[model samples]
Target: MRSTPPPPQLQVVAVVGPTAAGKSDLGVELARRLGGEVVNADSMQLYRGMDIGTAKLAEDERGGVPHHLLDVWDVRETASVAEYQRAARVEIDRLLAAGRLPVLVGGSGLYVRAAVDRMEFPGTDPEVRAALEEELARGGSGPLHERLAAADPAAAAAILPSNGRRIVRALEVIAITGKPFTAQLPGSDEEQSVYRTLQIGVDVARPELDARITTRVDRMWEAGLPDEVRRLEQAGLREGRTASRALGYQQLLAAFSGAYDEETAREETVRTTRRFARRQDTWFRRDGRVHWLSGAAADRAQLPERAWELVRDALGR
Candidate 1:
């Protein structure tokens, strides 16, 4: 058992990294040492009944820490970052007021930033949004992406062409604000956070992380991810605006539609997840505030201590 007492001024700690990089376990350990509770920042983990695919820690795996902002959305609901920001801040504030540290955990870069950084969402214009959404529905994302590329090449480069939702929103912002979406976004270091934060990033080498992801996907299959998906399907997962499009679930649904076999779907899930992890790594690496610690097996024993050192440094201990 960990015997070191909790720190006096443990305010906020963000455990961030790519999938299968050991962020969750490390966050639990950090929360234990900091007298903290966890508030999730994973966008996918917000959906109910998404446990196995999201690698959401079961109750027994959390090491008794109280967690918030998970399983708050039904499968059919569309995800909203603004709504998530509000909900997460409420819990963080409650935890602070109650004298418990707030451990913000996950690899969703934008969601994490929305919770901690002073980011403001611009107002939406209904006419502009409706027109843009109608265009997206008609011509697919390719034409719209070309337009975005012409208008704001940076945002187009950042967002995927197949991501019609974000592309539409980006165009909507351009039409409404008459400015590039990225122009209004905060730089890595320009914005101030709502609370004092010590963000610790857990990472391993590419090969090591790839191996971990493969092993995790294998384990999820063995743990009946198909069964979980089936249950969610009964609960309208296919109709979900966001949940149906998640990593593993999307691949599995393709299999269900006879697009591929389950084995092929699983294999593709591993490959797609590896690519997603690379993107996640790039996102966290761009941030200057995070104190990164290796999650290699050799370093696993010292991860908690290394994170504690960062916390102490942040506290000027």
Candidate 2:
């Protein structure tokens, strides 16, 4: 008798949403129920020694489920979504080959897209990139950001003025392609995904999310975020272009450097984080493939079961 063809790999399930929406716990619960492992998609969580501010789950909190891609990069190394995409796909493929589901989880929308979607990053010209970096160093991000705003208002709106690295990248892309940077993103014509994916978005009201963010930031401070930053700063965090700019770390570093007081840094962190959450919501809302599930704070107890129901429904199980 002829050998039979192997079974198709199961669809990759992704849990995504704004920060403070309880995605980590829900991902762990889903992995437990679905016989799956977790693949982290949060860009910040990929760095070592970034646990407290990123709200990374501890081992006990993971409930024995295997998690891949956490703490994969040093604080001194810049994070590349393309590199993350490749690494994440390797882990996902490994889990699938082992007959286990892969539950991809995080609030970083672009990283999630890079992992599962047919996303392609444009090649960078080193000369152009170097020139942009030099320009950024000499004049700061203000002039370049204004140019970006004129060239691609949407991209500029999405990127913060303080993010010098991204500002340079956008300008470089604009120069290389002779088109707006955002124009290269996957449009309706390029929606094909590499894996069979079931995307679940955790939804929370703005007020509740803002409140949660405040509480979480306060908890981070109580949990020794300052000390954590101090440790990482000794580990060369300030020299790490990407790692140094992480939400809480950036503000705390400013405080450590005497640019601001600790209280002001803490308050700015909360304010910027709330703004980031709004941007995350806007980004995910644009993707029509997401199946949104209510994740209100009051409904916390029911989230896991509700998430499981959504998964089962998606799979027609």
Candidate 3:
């Protein structure tokens, strides 16, 4: 009798959730079980020395599994979704060629979608980006939001006014490509995906996740997060840019300037993190492909077993 052949290669397994949801541990164990490599998908985790704030998995904590794309960029330099897609595709392909599964893990919904769905965000023109950046720097996000609202009301309705980065990027797309941002969203692309992907989402009740966010923020401060931010500030990396505007850094700035006390800063961090998590949930909920696993039973022992079952069932492995 002949032995059974293994299932065909799937696109990738994407483990996504809000902060403090144990995505990294799950990904590590899943990779160990399935002979997979972990790929970073979080926006903040790519920045060097942003460990505690971004909740990056330490090298030792990775359980000797090869992880890609984490801590590969300077915090001062920003990376776009298109860039992430390109890098992730190369990494994923390499993993497959090595006969290992690629496990993409992070809470950054846009980055995860870019890797899994393989979105084709329009190429950026420096002149167009410069123009939009100038307008945003001079006027602010309000004016840019107004412009986006006028041009693409649907996208404006979906995007928050406070998301200055996205608003400006959308306007840049319209200016550069002469096409609406909503229309450019990647639809079903059956041909491009290398493997049949299993998208796993870890979720908790809003209140519970918010509480976890609060606790985690307090813990970050206790772990010398302010010192980390001060180092970045002294390095001249703090300014009106993408990384500085991250929830952890923004709250710390307030504390450093006496606008808010340390405790208040921690509280604000929790609030902002909760809001960011909510936005992440909203962004990911639209994709019906994700299989949501509750954080209520988020245990080290159970998640791996369950996730393996889900992946095996999905891939017929």
Question: Which candidate leads in TM-score?
Answer: 2
**Which ranking of candidates, highest lDDT first?**
2, 1, 3
Model 3 bad stretches (over 4 Å): 1-9, 188-194, 298-301
CA lDDT, candidate 2, residue 45: 98
Tens digit per residue, CA lDDT, model 1, 1-317 = 97997654446899998999999998898888878899999999999999999999999999999889999999999888889999999999999889888999998888999998888887788999888889888998899999999999988877777667788888888888899987766677734777778889998999999999999999999999998998999999998868997888989988998999999989999998998899889888888988889999889999899988888787778
Q: Kindly report the root-mean-square deviation of model 1 from the true structure over all alpha carbons.
A: 4.8
With candidate 2 superimposed using the best TM-score fit, by how many Å does residue 118's alpha carbon deviate from the native? Answer: 0.8
lDDT of 1 at 310: 89
User: Candidate 3 — worst ten consecutive residues by lDDT sum?
Assistant: 186-195
lDDT of 2 at 284: 91
The Cα local distance difference test for each model comes to: 0.89, 0.91, 0.81
Each candidate structure's TM-score, on Cα atoms with residue i matched to residue i, is 0.92, 0.95, 0.89
Colliding pairs, model 2: none
lDDT at 13, model 3: 91
Q: Which order, best to worst by TM-score?
A: 2, 1, 3
Best by lDDT: 2
lDDT of 2 by residue, 1-317 (tens): 99998555447999999999989999999999999999999999999999999999999999999999999999999999889999999999999888899999999988998888887788889999999999999999999999899999999998888889999999898999898888767652224688878888999999999999999999999999999999999999999999999999999999988999999999999999999999999989988888898899788888888888878876777
